[model samples]
Target: MSDGEELTLADEIVARARIHAREVIDESELAVDLGALEWDVSARARRRAGLCRWHADREVATIVLARRAYERYDWPDFAGIVRHELVHAWEFQQFGESGHGDRFRERAAALEAPRYCEAFARPRYVLRCLAADCDWRAKRHRASKPVKSPDQYRCGGCGGSYEVEHVASGRTWTTASGYGGAKSALGEEW
Candidate 1:
């Protein structure tokens, strides 16, 4: 596309991103809203397709991707891309760079989004049983807490020795850990 055409498309993308930023700010119920900040977002032909925040005088702004990245990546929708950037906008409004802490993780999770608002595919982790015959597979954003240590395993058909792995606070450990599990083994087959 010509320079003028690119500029127009970039403007449109920024406008939509700003709107979504407002929505995220409202939904977060953060101390400061996106409207309260004096920021502007525009698209640029960057190597990577993503959003970034620019802070100015206590206010934060964002710039999303332009046609280059999207065109290269075959992005289908603009709204989703904008929404992801808007999340960063909301983060800036809330905690000013530190907003990406546990609270942010919680809010993002609560959003029930398969991918970021920006439409970038979320990270995926594949879990497979170590056993050769076991074809059990699981996909998750984060790994589940381990109820048992790596030394533990259970047989579904025949009762085998297995320890439960408890995953909490983003840490995984076996029930045998000091976190209290001995008394909790009610019907444990192991």
Candidate 2:
């Protein structure tokens, strides 16, 4: 596609983003642009098709669309993703809130947006059984230290030992130590 064609899509994205932003906090002075929506490919594995990055000092927010993930969805689904991020943008821009807090919920409800986005295809962490013929698998996001060791736990299916594996979700993992978990958290293991 030519540069002009690319700009058209970008323009549409910004226009739509602005519309969604106005839905929550309607302000004529609210200046938004496509400068915020970056095209990224790794958002698929991370399970986020769109992301909103807010800048307090500049009074600007950026929305990133996972190119690969966005391509898989229909126009309606893609628009929903844009709307979802806009809710976040509105929350941050108008109310100075960044999380799914009460104000965010209130605005989200007023906009009639989805409560949550779809989950990632893969879990941040995976647990597999070492014993042969036992197809046991468990998934989780956080792991505390003892949980990383295979000796402390056993698979209920064949009494096999457990092993821990961590997968990169296109983001850095920042934490001190190994991993640990409760039996209840591993509900499917039993």
Candidate 3:
């Protein structure tokens, strides 16, 4: 392997997840095997930090960690993410239940796990006022379905109607000018 080759992080994660499950469910009880663990870099930022997929027919489960968010979190945060997924796994195996129902909430509370299962994605669109020398903007989710005529919405700062200024992934934004078309300073419309 090259110097930059990634190590077996998935293996360690799987082992840790199993340990967490066993702790909650008890050692005498049969723990659900975390058969597969993968760091999915391709997963969208909107997705939760970790997801536990249970396979009833195969009697196994897989844990998928969002690589981008995982990379940013410290060990404690990462463990919390793992414990959150494990709670789901334990609940599924022991009770055959899904979703954040009463049972799931009760079990999670006993184990002191994170309540939320999903995370919100970063804003994908930006709306800015068209008024010259006025600086006002808004960040919107991809699913927000921006209005057909964004110009109808007034800016909070200058009380001017808003116009679509930037559209892209991440937090970067570009100015949309009627005279010059589009220009960006520090990747912001202002």
Candidate 1 on 1-190: residue-level lDDT in tens?
4666555555755565567666655665534455554434334434335655657574765555556545544433554454455556566766566345576566555553214433233423333354565655433443344333323444343333333322222232333452244324422521
Error of 2 at 179 (Å): 9.8
> CA lDDT of each candidate?
0.47, 0.57, 0.57
Candidate RMSDs in Å, in order, are 13.3, 10.4, 8.1
Q: In candidate 2, what are the lDDT values of residues 1-190, reduced to their tens digit?
A: 4666555544555555556555534533333344443332243345567777777777676777665445577766766676667677755666555777776676556556565666535566666777789998766655544245556667657877766665552222212223333333445552
lDDT of 1: 0.47
Q: Name every residue pair that clashes in candidate 3.
A: none
Which candidate, 2 or 3, has the higher TM-score? Answer: 3
lDDT per residue, candidate 3, 1-190, as tens digits?
Answer: 5898776655555555456555655632335444432223324545467787767776455566676555667766666676677667766666665678787677566666677754535554567777899987776654233323454446778887766544542223222233123333424542
TM-score of 2: 0.51
Error of 2 at 175 (Å): 18
Q: Tell me the spans in candidate 1 whose CA falls farther than 4 Å from its real position.
A: 1-7, 23-32, 36-47, 69-77, 98-101, 112-190
How many residue pairs clash (N, CA or C atoms closer than 3 angstroms) in each of the candidate models, in the order given? 13, 8, 0
Top-TM-score candidate index? 3
- Give the residue spans of candidate 2 off by over 4 A: 1-45, 124-190
